[model samples]
Target: MIYAYIAVMAITTYLVRALPLTIFRGKITNKYIRSFLKYVPCACLSAMIFPSILFATNHIISGAVGLLVAILFALRNKSLVIVAASSCVAVYVTELLMTLI
Candidate 1:
């Protein structure tokens, strides 16, 4: 039964990825469609990552503070390393302060 379920899921996943390639053989020429497609990966990535960002820490408030710091760093066009490090630091400091208080 578990094997059957796994097979079904595998087939469904394969079909989803295969169908798009088979259907969209020609280049998409519509400007609006092109623009939307360009942002889809980022949108999808954000959707997947944003929730984890808020809940990864012991405290939601610390997580939010880290998220804010990360966003601020991103707005300034900081390097990925810098953004991530600063966010981690922010979360650590927030957590420490919360513990002390």
Candidate 2:
């Protein structure tokens, strides 16, 4: 049953990732659509990250720490790799301290 669940999730995830590229190939020439597509990944990432930052326990302190780290990385013009790594470290350290306390 667990294997079946994993298989189903894997298939669904693959389809979601592939469907857009497969269906939209050669169909996204519009300038506005192209502009919107450029922002989609950032918007999606923000939506995923923001909730944890905003509403997690110790909201203000944790969120501020994460936000500050993110902004610092951004200001440094760091690559996404660096930004993501730094943010993960910040969140992990914060959570660890929370657990310890």
Candidate 3:
């Protein structure tokens, strides 16, 4: 039963990924559609990641602090490493302060 479930999942995942490639043979030339598609991945990734970020730390406040720090760094066009490191530090400091209070 577990094997069957795994097989079904694998097939469904493969089809979802493969169907797009087989169907879209030509370049997508519509400007609106192209622009929408360009941001889709980022939107999807954020949707998946944002919730987890909020729950990753001991307290929600720390997670929010980290998110804010990350966003500020990102808006400033900082490097990935800088953004990530700063966010981690912010979370850590927030957690420490929360513990003290």
Q: Whole-model lDDT, candidate 1? A: 0.95
Worst 10 residues of 1 by lDDT: 47-56
Please give the lDDT score at residue 63 for candidate 1.
Answer: 89
Tens-digit lDDT string for candidate 2 (1-101): 99999999999999999998888778678899899989999999899777666666465676768777988998999998999789778977987898789
Q: Rate the local accuracy (lDDT) of all candidates.
A: 0.95, 0.83, 0.95
lDDT of 1 by residue, 1-98 (tens): 99999999999999999999999999999999999999999999899778887889998999899999999999999999999999999999999999
Cα lDDT, model 2, residue 16: 97
Higher-scoring candidate on TM-score, 1 or 3: 3
Regions of candidate 3 where Cα sits further than 4 Å from its true position: 45-52
Name the candidate that leads on TM-score: 3
Higher-ranked by lDDT: 1 or 2:
1
TM-score of 1: 0.67
Given candidate 1, what's the lDDT at residue 8?
Answer: 100
